[model samples]
Target: MLKEFYPYEYARNVFAIDYKKLAQMGYTGLIFDVDNTLVHHGDDSTPKVDSFFAWLHKLGFKTILLSDNEKSRVERFNKNIRTQYICDAGKPDPKGFLKAVELLGEPKDKVVCIGDQIVTDIKGANNAGLASILVHFIRLPGEKHIGKRRYIEYFVMWTWKHRRKYRHRLGDILRSGK
Candidate 1:
């Protein structure tokens, strides 16, 4: 059902997330998708990304990079950030998400997964019983040729946006810092 694809929160970008609020909400562990969630596909970590991880560490949150890409790709992006990482994660399967929870040593109720895709990220989180935050995906050049999955995702997103109960008021969290 579409409920499985619903994210607990939605943010425009990783940088736009209100981590303080998430921490206050008792989310001590963060599982993040690399491509399109933290940076463009196949891109290295930006200085901003590095700083963000540093900030998260300072806030006492355990973080990990979870990617469907191969080990080399995940390693390259995580080189500077140095968070724990799991590659070839086989997402939307729940196994990887559960593995991340184990690796973080955090309770399921205290962890969250953040990613750009509903099919992989949100569904996997839901299946694993972890909270999820969805970020708009970064588009690649020649994106139209990528696949038809984006179209389906767009339809799902439209439906999600129209449902107020499923939407998280992230703006208020960002503004009030609560």
Candidate 2:
């Protein structure tokens, strides 16, 4: 499933993505997950995400935020980001991704869906016939309510370990201040 493919294996968080690099790879559109992706789950407000969105636009990669959370939550987060978004995305189902493609008028071959959770992001993207990425969630301190999800995520990552060979290789360049 998730472990057999390289595209599903080596994804870092949406923000850490190299849009220019992706453009080189012929990807022209991006779909992102919110919450711990663009901001801490508890924060509600997106921080520093504006700059990244701006950069994505300049690089010619249209972005869309997709989340299973309610419409209000997605709408609130999209306020300052200036990007299209879908709420109650029911991710892992391919509906949201399909909707996004329709909205962007872009083909699956030129689209890459980026998110943190494998069950949600990867599966949804794969089902939609789009390239997928599973990125580690942002680390925050003293957060609660993520209790069982951590275990579930661990299991996914455990399975995902099989594709480590194709995982994100830009780690060095990304951390080197690129």
Candidate 3:
């Protein structure tokens, strides 16, 4: 059951994701988590992020931000990035993922969900029948409450890294869950 939280893949950060490869692999849409996935918690978009989104557009991938934050926060953060978004989205819920796919007007099999959290992002994408990519958070989290959740995620990630049949192909860096 814990395997349900495992991501289809992991990357060092959002910038590390290969958009070309994703497009080539037939993923036409991307659903992203805004917080730690795209930027530091509660921070606005960076120039790098802006460029990345532009690149995604150029590469023919429709993008959307699906965040658990309030509309104000999501709107404020998206001002510079300028992607379609749904705020206060309940993650780990199939509804949000389905809604994101609907917003993109794409089939579920052609969409990929990207985020930093396993409990929400990976689980939700898996449940919604979308491919999921887990990326390391841009910065250390400020909240103390997330530490325990992080610990739990580490255990599950460890299982995937050490025991899964595909672990050998993931290499040490990603398996380390740095």
Candidate 4:
């Protein structure tokens, strides 16, 4: 079950990855998960977002933002980023990932996802068959709301923080290219 989980999904603090390096990696597309991955959760917007989006735009690679949040929330970011945004994505579901892939206009083998959580962003990226890169959370936990998924959130954070213990398996999977 955990095999379907994504170890990446983070836009920050991920394994050594440079955006421009995608060309060398042969990746033509990039996928992002908003909320805690790109900006502080519940913040409704990002600081210096124009520059961040600008970097992606300058990369010449297509970018997409995938989120489980409602369309309105994703729309809030549409104006800032020069890419397609998919909301109500229900990560680990692969629907949004597929949509992003479809919108990317590139081969799936050349796309990667960046997000903060395992159950959602990371898991979804794995199921969607994209390279996963985990990043540290941009917001504090209090930013998350009180809900059932909150438990899952805690569990994922535990796994991420302890990833060093299980990292070898993750490395094998990523390297195997299966």
- Best TM-score among the predictions, by candidate number: 1
Q: Which runs in model 3 stand beyond 4 Å of their true positions?
A: 140-146, 166-178
lDDT of 3 by residue, 70-121 (tens): 9999999888778899988898898999999999999888888889999999
User: TM-scores of the models, in the given order?
Assistant: 0.91, 0.82, 0.88, 0.74
RMSD of each: 2.7, 3.1, 3.5, 5.6
Decoy 3 TM-score against native: 0.88
How accurate locally, in lDDT, is each candidate?
0.88, 0.71, 0.83, 0.69
Q: Which residue segments of model 1 deviate by more than 4 Å? A: 140-146, 169-178
Cα distance off (Å), candidate 1, residue 153: 1.3
Which segments of candidate 4 are over 4 A away from where they belong? 6-16, 141-178
Q: Where does model 2 exceed 4 Å of error?
A: 1-7, 164-178
Order of quality (lDDT): 1, 3, 2, 4
Using lDDT as the measure, the top candidate is 1
Q: Pick out the ten consecutive residues of candidate 4 with the lowest summed lDDT.
A: 169-178
Candidate 4 lDDT tens digits, 8-118: 433334333566656566778878888877776755655466577777677787888888888777787666665688888877898789889999898998888888777
Candidate 1 per-residue C-alpha lDDT over 96-178 given as tens digits, one digit per residue, 9 for 90 to 100: 99999999999998998999999999999999998888888977677766557778888888899899978883334443331
Candidate 2 local lDDT, residue 77: 78
